[model samples]
Target: MENTKRKIIIVGGGITGLSAAFYTKKYFDERQIPIELTVIEKSPSFGGKIRTLLREDFIIERGPESFLARKMPIMTLVKELGLEDELTATNPQARTNYIVHKGKLHKMPPGLMLGIPTQLTPFMKTGLISPLGKIRAAMDLWLPKKKGMEDESLGHFIQRRLGKEVLDRITEPLLGGIYAGDTHSLSLQATFPHFSAMEKTHRSLIVGMLANKQKPAPSIAGLPEIAQKSMFLTFRNGMTTLVDRLLKELQTEHLITEQGVQTIVQEDGGYTVHLDNGQQIQADGLIMALPTQQTAKLLPNRSSIQWLERINYVSVANIALAFDEKEFTYPLDGSGFVIPRKEGRLLTACTWSSSKWLHTAPKGKVLLRCYVGRGGAEEWVQLSDEQLITAVLQELKEIMGIEAQPIFHEVTRLERSMPQYPVKHVEELRKVRADLAIHSPGVYLCGAGYEGVGIPDCIQQGKVAAEQLAAYLEL
Candidate 1:
């Protein structure tokens, strides 16, 4: 008699890990393959950056608030998980956003898409840019495209075509906020290759964007009315609702939490996972969903995957301050505002949560979501909680004239949460994956640190990893 059951383990219970586990089991079940699957998380929670807090009538997201409606991967996953009905979109009417210039907030121009000016009237009439800056930006219409496909900095690309004013006043604040990185060192090829393609196709960023604007959007027929009309979507309850649903789909007995993987030992043509809690598990296949830095630590022979350790991360913090309706002086007229690094302010950006998402607060209540720290200047993230809150409040007072104390507040500090993509990032990652295939045959790596950093990207990476693992096991 011979043992026949195969064991597969996924380290890290974040979206990537859960997705890998779910898809792997689904694949195995469809083929009637007998295998044992386990998911382990270091934290006592499942969703790594998707936690929600419910206090009284307010629902606050501690991690990612929502996903873009256009990200079809997440949309498909939501539908497959029977959560389509739970999807909700941003408030349709509260669409205005702002950018801080010289300590004052200026409404974002109407036809600005991702910091590129598409409409002429609004760009010319807007006071956000000086006359010289506006004139420089208009030169993009006649600027020559770069000569080659060589990689460049996002800052350099924007500066070269439209000028530095647009990069500082518009793109740096809006786009830089996403990666929490300085545009000067950020890679254009790895982070936003589409911009380069846009230039190639139209010879002008503005002209390319104008063409994009004229093109009719794809048919989103049969999607929920809210999802069809909105650019972003999330569950009515919160983003963590997806995490909760994924939990129910998995085997409860195999979902291990509060324990992390210590080291991995190779034996018997398979692997042994040693847990930090002084336990061991044997597995024929493994999926490493942890960050690249953590993954490098577990591998015995790390000479090949040394690049993993080179991938860098930046720390940041988000604070949600609540106020009584009458006590809050600033009108919640817009979605929020972003502050450019040149402004030299402690606050990076602020989101009027109550206005942006109607479900975030009760009627007559206000919720303001403020962010601190950026890639170039993130030392403030290590400040004490009280000190941090005080600094944010002071800035808010000057920025929004909110001198009143918040009725309640919640602060979340994420250390090394955002990954930075350097030049030639895609090629570097490809080389590492090939090295992994040759060195660790049965192990797979998929997470934000590898391919992409968005929620949909992580989920897709997980599903792809599962497919590769199943094939490796010849299932």
Candidate 2:
């Protein structure tokens, strides 16, 4: 008997891989395509970095905390999984974001969005920037926009257009903390092309942002309240809720975890994936939803994909400490504070989970998620648990003046987690995609390494890859 179903294997069962499987199955069903889906995960768990800890009445996230709340692809999947009711917005009361400057926490101005100022008054009044710095930043309005569209470093762009002061104090830390990257090397095009677009269109980043802010935003009208309230949102219980629901939707029949792929070889106009457990699977098509370098390693052809190997990664760690309200006396009204690279602090950023997410902690308990390690300063990620905790605690004490100990703490070390996008990343990736399309017709790549790093971004990438795979299979 001849089997008619096409064997489509999805490697790496993280959010991106899972999303790909989910969408592939959906698209196949919609198009009436005979498809058999399989998902392989090297880790013991399905959700790659999205680990959530539930202890007592606290919900702590070890990996990513929340994602941007916008009309992105994650919203559609959430609604499909019946998770719209579980969405949780950040606490409205905790509105401020502080920056560590001169060993003191300074409140970031109100009108700053992602460290770029939209309002002049608030930026000029900010304590984090000096009067001279503010004056330099104001020069952006008069500074002529760079003529060429050639790719440049984010640090260079910010410092060139605004000033070195804003880059060091605000934008660098705010954006750097997102990728655990040093903004100086991050590709302006690959990381945030919108910034470049603003410069090209308006000639002044500040004036452009101000104009964009002033434009009347489209009415939300009747969207869910949580979606309307804040720019970021997560599940009420934790981030794992999304993964759990995805598992239920996809079912465990197709998932294979705790199994690593030893190698992938082309066979019979398709592919044969060899697993570490001495098992082989035939695939008519493959959705390689893994790291860029890892995907390149598995492909048959060598030279074309070598550029992907150039993409670098950085290690990071996070410490989550739980405390009874009495133990945390210092006023932590804001969500948290970001430490600039110039501060020479091991800790990069700290999130007041209890204060930020009202649902994360019970009435009298507080949870703090402290970030550790970033580019050029990531050696501490390899520190022993005791040593790391002691050092972080001492720093927290010096910064916030809190002597009380946490009831309990958990540390998560994520090695090689953050993908670095150096200058020319966008163009390089485009060429690689073209090479894959020409050299390896049935193979595709999608994950944090290629386009985006956020959870929602990963989901979108998965959806896109699945759509492309579906189109290829139909052909």
- Write one digit per residue (lDDT tens) for candidate 1, span 228-327: 7898887889989999998999955398999989899988879999998889999999999999889988875565587778778888889999889998
Clashes of each: 0, 0
lDDT (0-100) at residue 284 of candidate 2? 82
- Displacement of residue 96 (Cα, Å) in model 1 is 0.1
Compute the lDDT of residue 326 as modeled in candidate 2.
Answer: 80
TM-score of each: 0.96, 0.97
**Alpha carbon lDDT of residue 298, candidate 2?**
86
Residue clash pairs of candidate 1: none
Per-residue error at 112 for model 2, in Å? 0.7
User: In model 2, how many backbone clashes occur?
Assistant: 0
Alpha carbon lDDT of each predicted model: 0.88, 0.89
Evaluated with TM-score, which candidate comes out highest? 2
- Alpha-carbon RMSD, each predicted model: 1.8, 1.6
Q: Which consecutive 10 residues in model 1 have the weakest lDDT in total? A: 219-228
Question: What TM-score would candidate 2 get against the native?
Answer: 0.97
